[model samples]
Every structure is written in C-alpha cells, then in structure tokens.
Target: MQEFFAMGGYALYVWSSFGISLLGIVYLYFEARKYHKKQQRLVRYWLHRQSKKKSS
Candidate 1:
C-alpha cells in the first residue's frame, strides 16, 4: 500500500498530474453544458423571431 502510494517516490508528480487532469475534465463538462444550453436558447429565439416576422 505504501509503495503504491509512493509511486516509486514520484507520488507528488503523479498525484498532481491526476488532479490537474480531473479538474480540466470537470471544467470542460460544465462549459459544454453551458454552451449547449446557450445554443438551444439562441436557436429557439431565432425561430420565434422568424415566425413573428413571417406573420407580420
């Protein structure tokens, strides 16, 4: 267990890298969701405007 944790004395580097990668993945996930919702809203707005213009 200790050996695994130590990672042959490279534990700090290994752990830091893993932590950074995890943070990046989490950030990307949230950003993607936010952008997706924004895009949907824009599309809906545009469609509504087009319909209104056609009616007028």
Candidate 2:
C-alpha cells in the first residue's frame, strides 16, 4: 500500500538506489553480450586467417 511505497519515509533513497542497481545490472547484461559477440567475431576471424595461412 502507501506504506510500502513510502518505505518508512526513506522512499527516495531506497527507490533511487534500487533503480541505480537495476540500471547497473541491465548495463552489465548488455555489455557482457556485446563482449561475447565481439569475442565470437574475433574467433571467426582468427579461424579464417588460420585457414588462409594453412592453404597457402
């Protein structure tokens, strides 16, 4: 109810901290995915180069 939202008169601090933590988690998730994609691309590129070298 209202009391839950108010959070014992510390709603601003509590909610802001919670929001910041949520944003941080979301940012980390996207960053990790981006890093994973970049690593995959690098691996593919490395394999391609290795094959080229072997063929030569």
Predicted structure with the largest lDDT when compared to the true one = 2
List ranges where model 2 is wrong by over 4 Å.
none
lDDT of 2 by residue, 1-56 (tens): 99999999999999999999999999999999999999999999999999999999
Per-model C-alpha RMSD: 0.8, 0.7
4 Cα displacement, candidate 2 (Å):
0.6
Model 2 earns a TM-score of 0.93
Candidate 1 regions exceeding 4 Å error are none
Error of 1 at 41 (Å): 0.7
Candidate 1 structure, TM-score to reference: 0.91
Best by TM-score: 2
Candidate 2's displacement at residue 19, Å, is: 0.3
